[model samples]
Structure formats: structure tokens, C-alpha cells
Target: MDRPSYGYSAADAPPPQGPTGGPSEQPVCPRHPDRVSYVRCKRCDRPACPDCQRPTDVGVLCVDCERELARQQASTRPRTAMGGRMGRGAPVVTYTLIALNVLVFVGQTLAPQIVEQLGIFAPFRALAMPWTFLTAGFLHGGVLHLALNMYALWIMGQYLERTLGPARYAALFLVSVLGGHTAVYVIADPMGYSWLTGTVGASGGVFGLFAAAFIVGRRMGGQVAQIGVLIALNLLITFTVPNISWQGHLGGLVLGAALTAGMYALRPKASPGADRQALARRSALVHGALVVAAVLLCAVLVAVKTLLVLGG
Candidate 1:
């Protein structure tokens, strides 16, 4: 007996005719077309199998729709207070700096001449290899020296990188290195033994990070008493320990603190009716200007010291 088409259950119903007048197959999942799916995505209304279905507030969404939604949400997400991304990804700049320092240390161990070639020497010699002022920050004197600086960098970098972003943080470290080397050049007596000695270590950059961390921590209302103690102990060691460059440590600390304080002070403040994008642009410009000013200050100091030493 022929049953009415309306009376047939979906599973038992005759397959629809194709354009060529052949029996058409049932609807299948787009991702896995071999499997037939009775369920369809609520959002896109596309056939989605159990594996491709993701539960949402209203109904199941296909994987593609869910991924698209996530992308959209991430695009509109807010940035950090200091204009850095909110994502908690690995600190690439910090790790790279550490790795570079380690590799340089390995080179130093393999070739004893690396220290002489890369380390900062007398002001007159530095004019020939000006890069030494920055490169010296990546060269370590000993295993203990490398370990301590790397540890301090790792501790402070993880926080500062996330707060200030990579470019700003890199500028801070590099400028502080310049500041440290410049201090050493300006303070060293041409006739003294220290003037001819080559200085190597990441202490200058690490000290800069320490100072920045202390300032940022205090500004963000975090407990900074530990940072204070750390700085004080290191300063004490810088003076008491032989071969330690007190000038470099003091120079880096002072520069880092001043730069960070100025950056924070000049940062854009939020207001009820303020334009966020405009505020972000203003913040970036101010921060960039501050970093440039710091670099210029370091250059000026080096120049003045060179003139004084040459004139003497």
C-alpha cells in the first residue's frame, strides 16, 4: 500500500531527486561529508555533526562560527594600562636578551679575546668601537656575574615587559647601558689604572630594570619594600666589592628611576568623555619622546666627558 509522503518518517522518507533526476544523498556535515548529520548549527543553520558542535547560550554553534566569534571578541579586547596587549604571552624580548647574553658569555669562554673586543674601555678607545658601550652590557665577567644579572633580569623583566611593552623596555635597558658606560668614562681618571681597564657585565642593564621595577611597583600600589631592600643591598655590594663598577650601577639606577618616573608622570590619563584612541596616541608619543630625550642625554654626557678629557 502506498503511504502518503507526509505520513513517512524523516529516516524512512524517500531521498529527494537530484537535478539529473537521480536519487540525492542526505545532508552531511561540511567538515566530514561522509557522515550524515540531523543536527544543524543554530547560528549559521549549517549541518554540523556532534564533534563540530559547540554549546552556546542559545544553542549549539558550529566550530567555524565559534572560532569567528572568539576572534571578534579578542579584537575588541582592551589593552593594558601602559598600552601593552592584555594577552599573557611569553616575554619574548626579555628571553631574547637573556639568550643573547648567555651566548656572548659562551663566546667569551671559548675566546678569551671577546672580553677585550666587546667590553667598554677608556673613553678615547670607545670612540673607535662605539658599539662597546652597548655590547659590554651583554658580556659577563664570570659565572657568578652572569647568573646574578640574568636572575635579576628574569625577575624584573617578566613584570616590566608586560607593563611597558617590548620597545619601551628595550629602550630603557639600552639607554641605561649607555648611561652606565658614559658614567664610567666621565668619572675615570686618565692617569688612573681603572681608566685603562675594560668593563664587562649585564649589571648596568639589570640595575636599570631593578630601578624601573621599583618605581612601577610603587606607582601601581604594589608592595615595593622588597625592591627597596634589594636595591640597597646591591648598592652596598657595588661599593664594597672589588672590581665592581659603582659608577655604572649608580648611573643605571638613577637613569632608570628618572625615566620610569617621567614616563608615568606624562602618561595619558583616562576621563569620562575622553577619546580612547586619541589617548593611546598621545601616550605613545609622550613615551617615545621621553626615550629619545634619554638617549640624547646619554650622548651629551659622553660628548662633554670626551671634550673634558681631551682638553685636560
Candidate 2:
């Protein structure tokens, strides 16, 4: 039985109205006075006024409508068993750091002295610049150097960041950088170039991250022994290899270990209490002290260098 539909036409349309009962009434948002509601959410048949509109590339869904949909779908989701562990996927920070290192390495190779003058060329004394301490970790001498360090960084960073939140992870990284630079400033002389020293690559910070991860793993009573073996092997390499920043690596390791201990001391363990928070605060204070002490050490070393230069 074909018949004419009784849909409301434009002539019969009500004036625009907000979600609140207002003078306007054309499916307008309650919050917005001038906006007319024209969109409908597909998931839940809610009329979306301009303020309520949620736009997608293909369609739109209002916030309330999405909640309604999520409520429906949530019932279908099954609970998984316990003992779930984090995946060893690429940690965002680790990947970005590695990419930066690779890019700098390429620049060093292509531009030759350009990288050296900038002090981004790693392991090469004449090519390194004072600024290279920060930039060098982002540069590598060769394929093996780049690959090994980047791989270590990825593996260690993934493990550490998963355990520590992004904020603490960031702090740990910064501390490592400072530690590495301090080591370089203490041990490596600029030779003839006093304004800048030879520095390149992030082995120090990477080593520090590894050390922290190792300590944290042990504290959590997880993969302690495995990490020990890795650390030992790498340490052996520093002694065996030529022209590597052994001092920087060792410095970072020490700092990382200390920070990891600090983090563990701060954790709530099984109990969530004010006591735990207090302990965490105290732990942070200790860490801050260590950083200050390290800075002082760097200052002393710099002073000694000045005296030596004047005497020579």
C-alpha cells in the first residue's frame, strides 16, 4: 500500500532551540544559543547540536552517544587471566632517540668535517665539539657502533620505561646525560682545542638506562640474573675495544644504579599509604643531593684543569 509520508517539511520546522528550553527550537544544542543541531550519531541515535558534535574522518558521534556505545560493547569483552606482562614493543622515547642518533651519524659521514666542527662526530677527537656531549649520543662512528648502541638503548629503555612512568624515565635519562658529560669533562682533555672536547654518541646515558633497568628488575624480583650477564659483557667490551668512552659508560652505570635504587625505595610495594609517599619524597631528596654532588665534582675537575693549564 504505497502512501504519502507524513514527514515534517521546512515550513513545519520548529525554530532552533538549545538543549535547554529556549526561545529557539530547531534541534539546537542546550549549551549553545545560536547553533542548530543537524548531526545524528550512528552508534546511538542522539541528535548532536553544534557543541555536542564529535567529528571523525568518515562520520561523527556525540560524547554521550560514544559512552552509550562503549557501555554496550564493554559487556562483550572477556576478562583475561592474571600474570600478564608488558610487551617488548618499541618504546616511543627509545625509537626517537635512536632515529636522532642515526640521522646525526649520516650527517657526520656525508658532510665529513662539518660534523666534526659541529662536534657531533663521535669517537673522533678532532671532529668532536663541546656541544657533542649532547649531540654525540645522537651520533655514532660506524655501522656496528650505531647498531649496537641503538639496540642496547631500545632494549634497555623499553624495559625501564615500562616499569617507571614516562616522567621518571625522562628524569633518569637526563641524569644519565649529565653523568656522561661530567665523566668526559673530568677524564678527556681537549688536547689543543680548549673550547670544545671530543664527544659523540649516547653510550653513557644508554649504559645508565641499562644499569637502572637491571637494578629495577632485581628489586622487582624479576629478570635480575640475565641483566647481570649483559652488563658484564658490555663492560668487558669497553676494556677490550679501542677509543670507546669507558669512563662515561662507567659513570652512567653508577648513576643509573643509584637512581634505580632510589626509585625502588620510593615504591609503595603492597601498601598504599602516606608512609610510602614520605619515603618517596625522602628518596627524591637523596637523588637531588647526588645530582648536586656530581655537579660539584665537575666544577672541581674544571678548576683543576684550569690550574694545570696555567702551570704548563
Tally clashes: model 2: 16
Alpha-carbon lDDT, every model: 0.80, 0.62
Which residue pairs show collisions in model 1? none
Model 1 RMSD to the real structure?
Answer: 9.1
User: Model 2 Cα displacement at 303 (Å)?
Assistant: 4.9
Query: Could you give candidate 1's per-residue lDDT for residues 55-152 as a string of tens digits?
Result: 88999977887887776565456766575455368999899999999998888888868565756455658878888888889888789989999999
Q: For candidate 2, give the lDDT.
A: 0.62
Give the poorly placed runs of model 2, Cα more than 4 Å off: 1-90, 121-130, 189-197, 266-312
TM-scores of the candidates in the order shown: 0.74, 0.59
Question: Residues 187-244, candidate 2, lDDT per residue (tens digit)?
Answer: 6554634235455567888888888877767766786787888889889998798877
